[model samples]
Target: MSKGLKTLLAGAALLLVWGALAAYTAQMSLPSLGGGIAYDPLFVPQLLIGAGIVLAIILMVQGIRPLLAGIRIADEEPQKTGRILFVIVAVGLYFAAMPVLGFPLSSAVFLLVFAFALGYRKPVGLVATAILGPLVIWYVFTAGLEAPLPAWPSF
Candidate 1:
């Protein structure tokens, strides 16, 4: 009906479709061995992913806010478009560098680029933030969750 509601409903439909696919994949997959432990897709991570998709679909259907609101229009749409393009390029470069330089290095470069673009004067501070943010995320994901990242050469 309303714009926001319509958007949310569309998102919900997508989520449901994704979840159904996940469920089907999990059900059809055979157990795979990982680190001497066999992983069955019907449980754990795949199930969790499916649950998340279901939740998203439910939220979209519910439409938490009443009105369907469109994206806020920029006073000058060209500037907004430029910014979006820049962000896509920055993120693309970061991912491209990930396999070669690894996550830490690529993330650092991204942060630095973002800082400079946003008018940060101190190169030192930008470097620090870039380095530290990725390191922290790496620590949390790897150490905390015990999920190792994608390595360059299958180490």
Candidate 2:
């Protein structure tokens, strides 16, 4: 019920999901172009996801420590409501728009909006993040590894 417990549970769930995904990928025979692929998708996601699961488990354990110390951020922070609201809205919009606008567009918009909202008030920083995040992400999936991103919607 508490935030720390909730965070622990969420991290546990993420670890489980990542573990399953990594196991599934392991069971599938990869093609002959064997090498690292966090940029490539060959063994990349599996590797990164597997590591993520481990890290999440670590986080889950660490999150429980504050409960041992009897400190709760959830009960005290007035800004918590606003933070949660913004995150929920942003995530909802991203998923909703992804199928409509495609990943690059949706992701770019999401980062730009979030950065701007987070008080990255300088126009240059805001513009640079808006452009750079998507460009870098696009290049990673498409050019670095030859992965395919979804096209703009209306297909």
Candidate 3:
């Protein structure tokens, strides 16, 4: 099968899955106290799923032209699957360590290791990013959004 045909089929499948999930989310019960309010627990999920379904449909429509013309899209260079797997494992470990080490510490450590693994060799840059990035993110989530984040370890 042509690449366009494959793309169209994949997009259609994704659209179907997203639509079903969105429908299911829409059926979930809202909080009783918030009956007259605009807020609903499933609102965000439904919105995101709706967006995904729209995007997938667009992709499928775009693919149809090339598919009908019997044109095959050129494949891109293969990715480094091993590096991808390593990053996934590293992220998993970071999340696993978060409860014990706390978000700031674990995130900093993860950033340092991840940067090094991705070929960033500058110690100053690595150290700065490791320290500042998590702090900024924590501040934004906690202060700006009024969301609570895991605190630093007391010890």
Candidate 4:
């Protein structure tokens, strides 16, 4: 299959999954805080799902345009299946390690290792990103969003 067709298929699948998730989240009952503290537990989830839906639609549009124009969008190069598997395993390990190592630490390690895997050889940029990326995300969650994140190892 052409890359555009694959993209369209993936987007369609994502749209279906996101639609299902939106439906499920919509069924979540809001807890009554009663003090006029207007809080919706599903707000963030709904926002994210909405964004995902938009992105899926955009992907579908982009993918279909070339096909409609009678253009064969060829893959730039053959994809490396082994690299894809490696990334999948790495992501699984990152998730498994998060509770033990904490989000910031686990994320930093994952970013560092993944950057190396992708042939990012600049020492300063690698170090900076490994250190700063998780820190920024942690701050955004913990401070900006008023959400708590695990910053230290559980053990």
TM-score of each predicted structure versus truth: 0.44, 0.48, 0.49, 0.51
Tell me how far the alpha carbon of residue 65 in candidate 4 is from the true structure, in angstroms, after superposition: 28
The 10-residue segment with the lowest total lDDT in model 3: 32-41
lDDT score, residue 70, model 3? 69
Error of 3 at 32 (Å): 25
Question: Candidate 1 lDDT (Cα, whole model)?
Answer: 0.71
Q: Write the per-residue lDDT of candidate 3 for residues 14-88, one digit (tens) a residue.
A: 999998897777677767457643466676676789799889999898879897886787656656889999989
Q: lDDT tens string, model 2, 88-149?
A: 89889888888789877788788889878766789887878777888788889988999988
Q: What's the distance in Å from true for residue 39, model 4?
A: 35
lDDT score for residue 87 of model 2: 84
Candidate 1: regions farther than 4 A off: 1-78, 151-155
How far is 50's C-alpha from truth in model 3 (Å)? 23
Off by over 4 Å in 4: 1-77
Ranking by TM-score: 4, 3, 2, 1
- State candidate 1's TM-score: 0.44
Which candidate do you rate higher for TM-score, 1 or 3?
Answer: 3
Write candidate 4's Cα lDDT for 50-155 as tens digits.
9999999999998898788888878788789999999999999999999889999999999999989989999899999999999999999999999988789999
Residue 73 in model 1: lDDT: 29
After aligning candidate 3 to the native by TM-score, how far in Å is the CA of 152 from where it should be? 2.8
**What C-alpha lDDT, on a 0 to 100 scale, does residue 140 get in candidate 2?**
91
What RMSD, rounded to one decimal, does every model reach? Answer: 9.8, 10.5, 7.1, 9.1
| Superposed model 2: Cα runs more than 4 Å off | 1-79
